[model samples]
Target: MSDRIMLFLLGFFTLTLTILSISASEDAVKPNSNDPVSFLCHEGEFFIKTRRNHSEANRGRPGEWKTACENEVLELDCGEDKTVRIIDVEYGRSDGTTCHRYPHFFMSCSSSEAYHKVHQRCDNKERCTIVANTDEFGDPCPGIIKYLKVKHRCEPVEPDTLKQVVICENDSKTLKCPKGTYLMIAEAFYGRADKSTCPHPKIKDTNCSAKNVMDIVGAKCDQKEQCELTASNSWFRNPCKGTHKYLMVDYQCIVDDLGYAAACENGNMEIVCKNSSVINVVRAEYGRGHPFVCNNSPTPIKPKGCSSPNEIAIVYGRCQGKSRCVIPATNEVFGDPCKGTAKYLELDYFCGEIWDPEDSPGAPIIKDVTKSTVTFTSEKLNKTTSSEYKTQMKGADEKDWSDVLDGKAFDLGKELSIGGLDPNDQLDIRVVKKKEDLSSCIPFARFRTKS
Candidate 1:
């Protein structure tokens, strides 16, 4: 064996070991949403065990209670196929709480009634996250240092297709599909699209919000048969109360041998932007992945609401028909929908119906450009400082304007190229003199970047 070959082999093994070590470290830090959590539970379960103070004793007055700091939130989530079922609950200076108090509470440990409020929000769900503070759950026995200790277990369940539910306030209907099957499509009608169920309302002008219900069904009900959809504010928010209304759902289920879907496949996101000035979202399906249907539990994406890295509707909505559009898919833009889901914004858009600025009478004309302040700041500098960077139009007659990006390229039908000469560059872009205004401004800036 040659000395060179031996050295090469040693280096290769060293690189392999380093890579494995880094991978192992990442696995430890990145807690998998799908991984079962074992916290203060026996098995297939988790405990709330929340309190302002870690002690079991209660203190404080009835309406005059204060937390040590900001109230803490504890979230217990079950994986994709299971839901957290409260086995038992002993609340209000009591023992455990896995289920009910009947959704009514007075905030006083004067009785065991307040605990019911906690049960209503968490029972039989894939995930339950409640703030461990009197302010959130209400100061049940206000002044006392009370605790919300719940014992819950996850159970395997799926949406059923054999459901026939009548419409009413806060009523939910679940449709269960058989095991090893996926819901291909779901057709739901609330008031009656065909004027079948209580179409003419015996009484006069009763506002049956049929259109709104249909829109909701498209967002939450389609491709799902197992979700427990209710007539409460969560879904339709009561389409019509006074008028007669009932829900009707018809769906088709397919076998799961075909791993990912083709038409409505995994990592599929679609957004239909109307030609109207207002981006009329005709359809927006963020998650079309199987097993990971509407808001799947134990997500691997950050800021929850997302199921996969195929989200495109959000980005599409931002710059669908614009000549120039820049969008950043960050927490600030779409807020955290789910805590830990490997989510991405992917929208399937064809290059059809292009918006040509040269053809439209209302072509974009950004005029009257003056001052531009780019706030830049970071650590070491305890404050934010705005730059004196500004730009002005030199020739309005020639449609002379300027655009300074933090280095971003447009993603439209064609590459939007902007570069030329007004006098030299047609636009003057630079930073003016600094101000001695002695304010809370720092000398640093950071633009949005991908994760």
Candidate 2:
């Protein structure tokens, strides 16, 4: 009986020692400084840990050994238990065949209970997956929890080539060649290279020069009689004549009787003069002699035919038939008729009648005359003059006069009659006495007859 009791006590003691040894071994494997275990927390998963060195004495305790491993397990804790927790997850080393990392991270939770409750809520959902773990669930430990930030990252992107370009007016920006200097390649450009060149000079040519050009304007000429050329300088007016000659003179070439070799000078030309025997010379002055005669004289004088005073005479041949004549009828001439002439002649005739001379001795029976005591009136007379009529005869032997009836007494027989007049009528007879002296002869005479 004593042996059996001692054996049972010994067996109980061995079992209790084996259980304590197993608990201690599990506690030794809890996360500590010497053994670091890494785990991942997804986006929106709360990260939580017991405080560092939390309950340091409880680490190897009888029931605390299992709690350490339980808390150290990788889980999504969303901080529902009032425990301090990381609200964001930071990326650490990833798991599986394909894994990636994120550059930035953010916090998502603030307390322990809220952290653990969030993990419990995402327990069976496809929202998250455990990436890595240091232990199983329900372990107690303070360990590092790494996570992958599932949020997208926005970065600046670059392009392959440059953008659209445009050319502006008056833009003088030069293009830099790959091997050459900055030069004005063209007037304008659009996309890249110089597609259009300047309108003036081309691309690879030099610039234009700065010089001036000259032009000449010819003068207008008027007449065909050789124009005189004048100019400012010798370059234009040298030897001015003919086709290209410049120095011109006043002389002109003409074909006259003098034969055509610079015939006229001093700006005057006899342009229309013909080359004939009678040369037509253009006189320079006004009153120079001309070939044709021109009469420029006054009239002449003449005289009357029958009178003379201080009168001008009409010389016998000087008067034309229609020429005017003048006569002096008065002491003063009325009109000086350009001639001193009697324009007409005056004459008188007389007859006396005789009867028987014995019957009427002293007186004749009748006496008549065609004209007696005539008065001549003209422009030559101051007033007038008269003439007498008589009938008488002169004897040759004695210085006496005889009656014209006595010499021819033998004609009438019974009654003697000299003129045809009646004897019964009383007639007065007048005899014209004639003297033998020639000086005493009557200037004029008239005749009378008895009845």
Candidate 3:
């Protein structure tokens, strides 16, 4: 493609994402949000606010602003006449390619995998506040003195502001305005999913074009309980057929009652399949959701000795089999990741022969086959912080194994599991303090091959 073509594409893509920021402004902030939060500031301006320094991008009324600190709630209240739109954020700092350290840079609107909870909950509204804690956003960066740096500006309230929704390809959703209100679309994009998106769609052709049909959807589904449509040509009239396409609808709902169900669910769940051949674990919830929005729920299960930090690896290590698995919502199993904040364990897995991992000679198996298990040579913790110890997976070749690690550099504990190995293989693990250094690290690991 030529430079002009690339530039045009970039412009179009930005517009598409911009629509998402506008639509579903409230739903976008709820828990389990799939949308990225990169606040769209049409009247572009850049500003920064830190614990030490404070500034505003554009001041409606110039004055000194308040300061925010850790363990405190940061409330950005734009009284009656103004609204705020966040553009970007940087929390803590970065370590190499990852930012998992404490006081980490957790939320940002500028990243491609941008965060949206801040905007969805706060933007274009009168008031919004967020707790500066790791439990709400998880430990994006662990063991770091963290501070939130936000870039945002306030705007005058628009009489004709509309809710926004950015639906991507293969994304079929039902959008409904609050009761007694009318739904309207001010912008629309129906065409190819951008380069930042899946280019060669596995389910559709590659040569796709973008299209806009906000008016069409508004005409048919407005003022109703909900509008249900798929991202296909038949639903929105493809702008370019035979090419991968997605619909971006920017809608604003006329005021009324949006009595959204505020109830949330948080609990430990177990899945069992009978007369099944194989099973595959898709997703699991072993941690707290965003306390402000969605995760497990308002009252997440909080047991004696378990929490989010280690629940995932622990659950998968125990229940990743062909048929049945049980996970308890307790601190004993997961060792409280976030104390005082309730938690839950939810798992999404598929059970079937087709979903099983492939097996080769000396590889992990998922079915009725018996094989050797993975065991550590020593039954003690590797007490050294900087030592590369090797473990072996019996009956499974090293080539057929992958690393499943919890990112603790000097793990006070370790948890690991391997794919492609026998399901019945019993792993023998021991973590003992090293002779050189008496620090205990629990880094449990296993290797398996799927067949």
Alpha-carbon TM-score of each model against the true structure: 0.23, 0.11, 0.30
lDDT of 1 at 431: 16
lDDT of all predictions, in order shown? Answer: 0.34, 0.21, 0.40
Using alpha carbons, what is the TM-score of model 2? 0.11
- Output the TM-score of candidate 3: 0.30
lDDT of 1 by residue, 1-451 (tens): 6766855765565466557435533322111111111111111111211111111122221111212221455565665555555443333443212122212211223222223333333434445555555433333343333555555556565566223345543466665566655443223456533344435544333435554443344335433335455655445544555554556554445442111211222233333333332221111223322222333334443332333222223443354344334444344454444444433332222222332222111111222221222112112111122233221212211222233332232222222222322111112221111332212111111111112
Q: What is the C-alpha RMSD of each candidate to the true structure, in Å?
A: 22.9, 85.1, 23.4
- Arrange candidates, best TM-score first: 3, 1, 2
What tens digits encode model 2's per-residue C-alpha lDDT throughout 190-293?
11123243222223322211110000101111112232223222223212121111111111122111111111111111222122211111111111011110
Supply the global lDDT for candidate 3. Answer: 0.40
What is the Å distance of residue 316 in model 1 from its true position? Answer: 22
User: How should the candidates be ordered by lDDT, best one leading?
Assistant: 3, 1, 2
- Please, what are the lDDT tens digits per residue for candidate 3 over residues 14-100? 455446434323211111211111110101211111111112233344332333344466666555556656655544433322323
Off by over 4 Å in 3: 1-67, 94-114, 160-263, 266-307, 310-451
Task: Give the Cα-based TM-score of candidate 1 against the true structure.
Answer: 0.23
Highest-lDDT candidate:
3
